[model samples]
Target: MIKVETGLADFDIGSETQDVARHGGGAIASFVGLVRDDGNLQSLELEHYPAMTQKALYGIAEIAKADWALHAVTIIHRVGKLAVGENIVLVVTGSDHRKAAIEACSFIMDRLKTVAPFWKKEVRLDGTDQWVEERQSDIDASKQWDE
Candidate 1:
């Protein structure tokens, strides 16, 4: 089972976890990214072309499924404006073994952060806004998988 989706609505983590678990995987691992409340932050606005975003997300999930021999993989990325502390994305990976499930979850998230075609802007409480830049830390994290 492989599920990839992008939209403005929030997702239910419980249902997602259950859906992956039902696929007969012995181990399941998941990650949920949330909008951080930096002192100046009011909200985060996310944008992406629908076709490109779906294709990219599906491609990443497929790679994880093949490389890790996963039984199931799920990725959900939310777009549009989101309030502080809202869920931004969810990644779940399930496999026969713990190591594969855990690592694949991390792998998918790393790729999503660096490769997914979503643009983000931060709106400050003071009414100022700025586009978010890719951080060196994120680039470095994604590079480790290439080694």
Candidate 2:
């Protein structure tokens, strides 16, 4: 099972992800991406194309399932004005082995950065904001898993 949301609330994906992995008695790994207080921005507002965002996330989940012995996965990304120190994204991967769970989590995050149709607009400290563009590094990260 997978759950995705765009609300501004803290999530508990680890426990849920662990449950899925534990169904068969194995390992689970998760990641929580938080907003940074870097000089580049004072705040971040995320806007996503609803339908496309869900589709892309599911696609990433499929890739993880095919590549690893995963039992369950969950990915949640918040969209809206998010202040620093808030959670931006969460990913959970379950598998029989620690390595599998860990690797799958990394793989999911790397691909999501590029594959997901999530646009981030950063509000600068100087009261200016700009939309972020897809970077080549993001594309390169996803390529590592290509068959």
Candidate 3:
């Protein structure tokens, strides 16, 4: 399952995990990204090119599936305005073993941070806004997966 939208995620992590676990998977790993209240942070706004974003996510999922013996993969990313503690992204990977499930989950997230066609703007508590910059650490993390 893959979804990209501008609405609330409202996902049930346990149910989603069960959905994947039924597919012969012995292990499930998940990641949920939330808007952090970093003192001055108020809210976050996310934007993405409709078709491009979905394609990028699907592409990442496909790569993970190929690299691991994954039975299922789910990625849900939220757009629009999100208050502190709101969900931003979700990644779930299922496999027959813990190592595969965990590695694939991490792989997808690392690639998503650097490769996904999404932009984020931070709205500060002081009524200031700025586009979030990509961190060098993210770039370095993604590089480890390069062939």
The residue ranges of model 2 lying beyond 4 angstroms of the native Cα positions read 17-22
Note the Cα lDDT for every prediction shown. Answer: 0.95, 0.82, 0.86
Candidate 1, which ten residues in sequence have the lowest lDDT sum? 48-57
RMSD of each: 0.7, 1.9, 1.7
Cα lDDT of model 1 by residue, 33-144, tens digit: 9999888899999999887898899999999999999999999999999999999999999899999999999999999999989999999999999999999999999999
TM-score of 3: 0.93
The top-ranked prediction according to TM-score is 1
Clashes of each: 0, 0, 0
lDDT, candidate 3, 60-140, per-residue tens: 999898889788898888888999998888888989899999999999999999998889999999999999999999999
Structural similarity to truth (TM-score) of each candidate: 0.98, 0.88, 0.93
Question: Which candidate number maximizes lDDT?
Answer: 1
Residue pairs in candidate 1 whose N, alpha carbon or C atoms collide under 3 angstroms = none
State the local distance difference test value for candidate 2: 0.82
